[model samples]
Target chain A: MSEQFEMVPGNSLITKTPEEGRQLAVKMARLVIKATQPDSAIREKLRPIYSEDAAMLISVGQVVATEFATIAAANNYWR
Target chain B: MSEQFEMVPGNSLITKTPEEGRQLAVKMARLVIKATQPDSAIREKLRPIYSEDAAMLISVGQVVATEFATIAAANNYWR
Candidate 1:
């Protein structure tokens, strides 16, 4: 899956409750996965080609792939 | 450069003024880069191995790689 997203972390969201942050995380991941699909037709492409690690990033976005789980765990999610 | 970051998109930042969003973008990019550096010792590692696409992702993150710049361009940045 080739996923391209614009994630801008802000103080407001970061300060939110863990539950709120978790919800936001799940939503963002879904959008990213959908956007990356060939049929998504988002009309906006990030890179001409998806790299070898694109899959890892896409899964991480969706909250299912744990390649980057430690990053989330340290922040108090996916414990 | 290997970078691990926790970026959560939300309505709060998305609804903010472009200026604010841009500032946040730059800051987030910097933090991700710093966190990924081996010497940074952030103590949190996302993927045990950086993929072939890791470089692209890292550069995309620091706002210098631009592999995913089009995503930003369409959203009203890097235009």
Candidate 2:
């Protein structure tokens, strides 16, 4: 599955059209969600800390998405 | 300043002690916040779309943080 997924080049989304920007955001969101699945082995390891650090998790996630969106707009990827 | 900050290797935080995991999360949070500063040039480009995409941004941020925390626990970086 990893082989099937091509790595997105750094900041490439910044150059896409507005429509493309939204699409890219959606794609990224999906990927993040998949990586953080509750039952995943990674999640199990992280769970105890996460239970106490929910606020931090949310803040970090917001930053990541914000950066992507910013890259999109800076490059005029969005209309 | 960029030269002073070494790029953290992928998943290095995962192997850190529990205390180290918390430190890493805090560090990552700070970095992300700096990158997404509201008045930064990048933010200016991203603002309009973000105004409409606030939910997405929040969601994405949560995911990134969650993944980091997961990595921390998976590697026994956190107790």
Question: Among these predicted structures, which one has the highest lDDT?
Answer: 2
Top of the candidates by TM-score: 2
> How large is the interface RMSD of each prediction?
11.3, 14.4
- The count of backbone overlaps in candidate 1 is 0
After superposing candidate 1 on the true structure, give the runs of residues whose Cα lies further than 4 Å from its correct spot.
Answer: A1-13, A41-79, B1-79
CAPRI grade, predicted model 2: incorrect
- Candidate 2 chain A worst ten-residue window by lDDT: A1-10
Deviation of model 2 at B71, angstroms? 19
Q: List chain B TM-scores, each candidate.
A: 0.36, 0.41
Q: What is the TM-score of each candidate against the true structure?
A: 0.25, 0.31
**lDDT of model 2 at residue B71?**
48
Number of the top DockQ candidate: 2
lDDT of 2 by residue, A1-79 (tens): 1212322324243444666655555454444433223235544444455346767467544655654544454454445
What lDDT tens digits, residue by residue, belong to model 2 across residues B1-79?
Answer: 3333434535366643433443354356545545446346775575445323334334544545455445444553222
Model 1: docking quality category: incorrect
